[model samples]
Target: MKDILMEIIESKRITLREQKKAVPAQLLENGASEERKMFSMRRALANSSTGIIAEFKRKSPSKGWINRDASPEEVTAAYQANGASALSILTDTPYFGGDLKDLRIARPEVNIPILRKDFIIDEYQLYQAKIIGADAVLLIAAALEKDECLQLAEKAHELGLEVLLEIHSEKELEYVDSAIDMVGVNNRNLGTFVTDVENSFRLASMLPKDMLLVSESGISSPETVKNLRQAGFRGFLIGENFMKTSNPGEALGSFIKQLN
Candidate 1:
């Protein structure tokens, strides 16, 4: 059987081929040059009370069709106004029901850093992220080799974009390079699609002490957030918890309040 992560990455390659033809690499480079001033997600998470990177995801392969009609502008504005330390906007269309338009729409509405949540396989996507007004990009360890991850991280930093390296297990830790600004432990197993928050706790002690730690997925409660924080996690990326609700921003606000 084929793995879901590999499947998404292969699909991403096909999509990127078409996108590059529609908008050449040079054009993307030009657009990146004109992007607004960059924000530091690392800095925001370090100083934030909630340390929440509120995510705006329409859907996922595991959970389908989550708020397909949610407006990025409305949701992101609410997230920022409510106390989101940063923003995460899914830009993958095939499996995640997101597009670059979502990030573009959300960019002007919020002042916080916005992470381009996608399966980054090549350097072209890094330029695409910069051109699309993303302050950061997610590089999944399971999707790329160690050298590829390091190269992508270097390229992202050169373009003034931060790299949030996502890892699922301890072996993936080798993918962490000096260029990575944040290390996120995704609790959901990409192969089985099962999530356990304990994955964060299990891996917390193994992560580099100097690197900022972020706990992603399977985090739904303020108590969970508080516990993760106590375990040395500075960032929490929550999506389905808030997006599943009728009012995601308000949901996020309530969650943050509970944390305080």
Candidate 2:
């Protein structure tokens, strides 16, 4: 049987195709060029004391409906006010209960970099991200071959957007390239949906020393962030812990205070 990750990617391809038909790539390019400006997630994380990339997500496939009615403006503004180094907004509507509109809504509310959290497979999506006002885009190594990953990363850079390459295992490290801005190790296994924080710890040493490292997914506590920082992780992508709460910004504020 096909795993959930594969299923989602397949479905995403169909969705992308349909979307491309509705809004041609040329149109996307024109709109992208008219965008205000792009922020650097890498620079923000490097300069921050906490290096927290607070995410805005409504739901996930594994847990289902984490915060169904969460507002982007409210939650993201809170994240910024609470010392978030950056912002990540999920734009996959089908599985993640998010839309591109979420990022658009949250963009004006925060000053830090915003990462467009999606399974980016096509170049069109990169243009869409630029047009939608995303600072960076996620490229999952598990979803694309090495060449495809490189092509996307290069294109993202060409469009003046940063690339956050996410890898779950050691083999995926080959996806790393010069065009990629940051390397993110996702603790959750996309195939099985099993989460293990140790994955980040285990893979930390294998990454390039010159590359900025980020630990993504399953990071909940300040203690875990401290440990990961000791293990050489410079950035942390946290979502569920704050998003599941009644006030994500206040929760993030409290979490940052604990970190300090």
Candidate 3:
């Protein structure tokens, strides 16, 4: 698993470098003016009881390919309609089989906040996030140092984009700060590639009170969400659970009905 993770990291670096030189400067231009309106991820979570941050992903490393055929527009619309507080769109291409185009296409279709769920290493991606009209960006604590997380969170904030700092364990909890708008407990162990909703349960009480909170990965049912919410998780990030089905919209509709 360590070897596989290293390969993923290397492949991501190669993809980033190749993409940087091929794309036009104007296409990646930072639209700082559009940064005026700030949609609060914390506020969204606070207002919702269910607090589901439904995700639209094409594929993943652990699960391989899932639903590459679903359009971003269709998925985002259904997620919003099914009581999702926000939308998480995977934009990494190599392993996830996702791209910025997927995120951009889903932007105008939904009214709720959109989270660009990608492996962000450089500041350039934050600007790219704004260019593609992303309302928030996911920053993994395991992938970055404390200082790096703070700097990236600040950059994303400057662009009116919320930063959801993802932590996989108690050790990573030290990186949390005011710069981040939310803190997410990724239930899946990226190192071992194992998932369990109980990971969120173990860490829920340790999270800070002020920031929005989310539980990511391994969330497949309303019962699991209920348990997590009871444990004080204000947000839930669900990915392949819905997209794995043939009809994601109906899949979401049924799950949401059960949730209610």
Q: Which stretches of candidate 1 lie over 4 Å from their true place?
A: none
Order by TM-score, highest first: 2, 1, 3
Q: Give each model a TM-score.
A: 0.98, 0.98, 0.93
Task: Please write out the lDDT profile of model 3 over residues 33-123, one tens digit for every residue.
Answer: 5543445667888899778788898898888899978899888898888778888999988889898988889888877888999888877
Total backbone clashes of candidate 1, pairs 3 or more residues apart or in separate chains = 0
Candidate 1 minimal-lDDT segment of 10 residues: 27-36
lDDT-superior candidate, 1 or 3: 1
Candidate 1 lDDT tens digits, 1-260: 55788788788899989998998988878777774789999999999888999999999998899999999999999999988999999999999999999998889888899999998998889888987789999999998889889989999998999999999998998887688899999999887788999999999999989899999999988999999999999999999999999999999999988999
The TM-score of candidate 3 is 0.93
Name the top lDDT candidate: 2
Return the TM-score for candidate 1, rounded to 2 decimals.
Answer: 0.98
Q: What overall lDDT goes with each candidate model?
A: 0.92, 0.93, 0.83
Q: After superposition, how far is residue 191 of candidate 1 from its true place, in Å?
A: 1.7
Clashing pairs in 1: none
